[model samples]
Target: MTVLTDKPESPFYEQLSGIVDEQILHLQDARGIFLLDKAHERYMRYYLRNVAEKPWNNHLLLSALVYVDKNADVRTIDELLQQVNVRLVDLFKIFHLSNMAEFNVETHMYQYLKGSYYQEHSDSMRSKLLALYRSLTYSTRKWVTSKLNSDQQSYFEQYLLPMPSYDSRDFSFTKSAKDLAKDTRKNETDVIVPLLPQIRAEGHFRWNQINRLRQTFLKACEQAKTTSMDLPLEFHYDEPERVGERFYFRLWDKSSFVLNHHDQFSASSLTSAYKRTGAYSEGNNRYFVEFVKAERLDDDEKAEGLWFTEIFEKGLIGRWNEFVDVTDDLIQQKRELLYSWGYGKNDFTENSFPFFSKHKGILTPSTFVSRNKHLAEGILFDVEPLYAAVTFGLLAVDIFTTTGARINELLQISNTRECIRKVKVEDKLKFSFYAIPKGRDEVEPFYISEQTMKLIQLVAKFLKEHYGTDKIPSVIYRGNRSHLFPEPKPYFFQYHESSFNHFAVGACLRFLLHGLNFESQEGKPVVIKTHLLRHAFATEAVQRQNLPIDIVAKILHQRDIEVTGYYSEPTPSQVAQSVSDLHDVISDYVDLDEAVLRSGEELVNELEEYKQKVGVFNNVLGGACTTNFVCPTKMQCLGCQAKVPQPEKKHELEEVIELSKDMEKRFTEMNLPVEVKKAKAMRKHARNELKEIELIEKYREEQKYEPHIQFKK
Candidate 1:
């Protein structure tokens, strides 16, 4: 049991408070004061020693202190103060300090009114403590800001302010893919583009092509091994980074004698796409297709020699045929294995997979699953496209579009965690889900549509059926390695074997959009990256769904509405259309003072066209501007003296007068002085503008058809 008492004037607290106040008033060196705060240090040490458990890790304080020291500036100081304040609040709560208490400077004792059960510090002490904390924080910030250089201050402010890290890999890759489509429009294709069709061809054609090529090369190598005594019978694929070189093979049609048996031939045989450069293969480990003059193809072509000789004689080789060496063979041998590659027919295997196959009940360990499971089963399933459609197709798109989630957030929905549930919202039950997204400290529940929920379920079911377990590997990679953290969870978004990371997810999205030939309204290939999906979701929520920007921010789990507002920024074309619309709406009311619109008599003819294009723009009913400035006053166009109402809009101006009167009536019912005062000012401005419009209308009516009255020069 703990005994609590208050003595109105404690000497220790009085000295501490006095020291803090004095330090705040005379603060100069922020770093020095922070280092010398014995009270704060003592509290932190005590907290670590006594109360640090579970969530209260000592590493947090250590990291925070290090971060503040490294970034010793105003922003860092401010962040430190916030952290300290939270910890202080936690400390106070732990001690059960609730009542009001005052620290008397003269008597050196804390004073408080006692309840029957216990004595505690009064609210005055709490107030003083908070005030002192704030003063110290403010002083420190002021000192640091005053001391910082312009660049440091600017960078600090820019980084400290809430903004999305938009250039994440998923976002950048989508933009790049869109750019590639643009290049295609200009009739310009990079070397990779031509090879893409070979590698990313429909169905499992690329895989089959690779397999046939590999078999032929190994057969040639085995023949050479029988003759030369030292060579591996088969070759293997290079690492993923070296995959590009394996595709660069030259075709040899079945006419010239190249194989031991003509029956071993396919439609065409492939030779090493690599050219035999006389340069030693020691440092140049990568394969490049070089076309050499036929010195009878340099003497070592076993099964592939005759094919190369025919191409060489026909002058088919050139300098422009260079490709990146993606050869799998890393070992250095005396004899070149470039001669050890030839083409062969693909070996047919029995197929058992089916088209549109359906399975019921729970998936088990015996599920015969592979990337090409459908094709292997000979079910006429286009497994390539289906693999993408099943893994990162509809569910991914729905989660991204509806939830405004970052890519990682969307991927965080694993079946291992019982995330999706029916939560009551607005007196109706909806399927909302939970995910502990990146940067967020804890699990946040996000409400999703029923369609999205179903899509998620479908993907979940597919993942289990494909992997034979609900527990798929988590997304963890370090440097050149993946699966570093091997703890398996039922991840919703993954391919046949890979646990989807940013790169895999991005590649799938690009492939899907490209395969589907998707395009954006901007006449460009649609950018389908994860962050773009989030932005698109936000934009649609505000522009189409009519959800509040703040609500969108909440759904996206953003810190502020300002960050969410970035997605809603208008494009140039959108701004241009808005200007056109505004011109059409107010053209009937205001006289054209600018020459751009009044250059010719064709204006009357174009009036109908403009109206047709803009339709009957009605944003003016609440007053509007096309410039997109965030006006301080909501009803800015109505009340601004520089933008007074024109005579032609008198009917609308009269409606504005009525609206202002109604607002005034409603504003009088409000008790808040500040809001009432602001509303009154707005109404007063509206009335003044109304009077001006009426006067202008009366003058224009009188002056009608009186333009003939001209002064003598």
Candidate 2:
């Protein structure tokens, strides 16, 4: 066994210092690396790590180990089994329950677990905790048991096998289809629907404006360099005169004016010039020219009223201390000016520059200038924050609503131009992006519209240019910066400083919704959760657009089509409409041509009497049986001519056809001639029924027929 000393410099050292036992740290995995070392570096970074929440899977696992037996040196699967005994489930329960209780001291865990409370933490918190415990235990057990010897594995199976089910035994309360739809619309869809167009428009506008400013700045700078003009050359003809009431600082400078120790002008002289004209230093020899309005200026000060534009010029004033002194004097003078102008000095303090602190790194209005409306008119303050919010917010909404991408998959989208691919489908091309779905190692193509692909590419280009990097910076997923991805991928959905992880993207989305002031049908303010957008997408696809459930499942990257069914549950109105449409389709199927039946009145009466005589029984494949007494063909409605197929059940018929084909192939391989013949007959019947249903649907689509004859059974 390799004896390893704890490295204090390790990032995990602090988190593990108090919670983990020293003996546990000494334990080794199948590899020579210490268990704690592996846990800190590699184990938690695996696919099981919870992306939606904080990176605490390793911490929780270590805590559980310590709780089981701090002194037990659990080196192998057998040893862990011996340590945990048959109390593995109990151990996790105690750990999670205690943790939840401690975190939520106000609520009683016993009551919460037993379903007494109606607060947010009642059902969801319990469910999440149970899921977390189950996931952690399964993952840890799999990792340990994989390296065990045959005899040891057998020993584990015999004694401590059949892991206790953590499935919450409490009564499960499920929402009805109507209730689910109502809740979803009131909470998620309605909120997002109103805000989407607004966000898209605003985001697009801001993006265009940012690009315009960038282009104008580049051109003005080039012009200044070529012309050899004095500092602060204004361009009145090219750019917009105002961005509201504020004038644009269309001035250009070839190089920053530096006032070093050898310069003739002192910091005091620059401060005096700034007091008369709204000008201040923006460190690194850069300064912003504020175009203050004439109304704010003193009568004695013979200076043009200037307001501060977002554009900054590279020009130095003095040393750090001198600059600070100048700023302090200016602040004092501004306060006196405000006080003399009947405004309170307390309202215009250093802290009032919230915009500057909120957006520190990005280009924003100068921090030195007060953001009071009276002081600066039409100045684009909070430019970067608004830009980031609107632009990123729209990108996230568009991607989520359009592609039905989970938050994690959306965040991990590669920044490369090749991320979005175009594949030729017959005569036309379709666009898709490759993303690693949750719980899967392999990547899947998420097909998106051409328009959405263009939007993503535009955002990617802007991000690359803004960061001045060839690619967007690599994002650290869940704080496991090293082991999350095989290599650093420049994730597209990120800010300059950090990636827009689940929480950040959520915050961005909420920020956009908050501005819209949209209200739900419940007459409450709209608050949208990001994941609900996925549900909305699925629901819309299945219920409104009538897309197949299997197709939606594939788009959502769900392995189970049943899960997709839960997402796209039809509302009551939808169910009624589907029933009505099915009635119409059935009626159309039974309709006789007037051209063939010349005795119309007698034929109609006979048809009505015939419909009453036939019995309608619900068949297995969502069709109705017209047999009066019993199913003479032993419920094989597919081959029966009396079986009336429903439009909504078309997918079920298709699935049956596929299953029959598979069975026929399997029977042939087994040399069962009788079974193969039966399977082939079943497949043919299902195909014929499906084709008839398609023709009926086509007839219904081509001709809108009001229900003239009502059939009763």
Best by TM-score: 2
Candidate 2 on 431-506: residue-level lDDT in tens?
4577667546567876554345556655666677678876567765432222235455677666665655455576
What do the candidate models score in CA lDDT, each in turn? Answer: 0.35, 0.45
The superposed Cα distance between candidate 1 and the true structure at residue 441, in angstroms, equals 0.7
TM-score of 2: 0.49
Which TM-score value belongs to model 1? 0.31
- The superposed Cα distance between candidate 2 and the true structure at residue 199, in angstroms, equals 5.5
Residue-pair clashes per candidate, as listed? 21, 10
Worst 10 residues of 1 by lDDT: 576-585
What would the TM-scores of all predictions be?
0.31, 0.49
Q: Write the per-residue lDDT of candidate 1 for residues 1-713, one digit (tens) a residue.
A: 11323221222233333322222222222434342221233233443444243132222333233333333322333344454445444444544543213212112111111111123433333333334344443443443456656654453332121111222232223344444444432221111111211211121222222223334443444444355422212222221221222222221111121231235333333131122122212242221111112122223433221222332221111210121221223111101221121111122121111111112211101111211122111111112233444245445554554456776566566554355544222332234567654434367876554334544655655565666763444543211111112355556665555455554555444433333333433443333455665654555445433446765676678777797776644322221000000000111101112213343555445344433431111134323222112222244455431131434555675676677566766767765566666566655655654554443343333323111111111
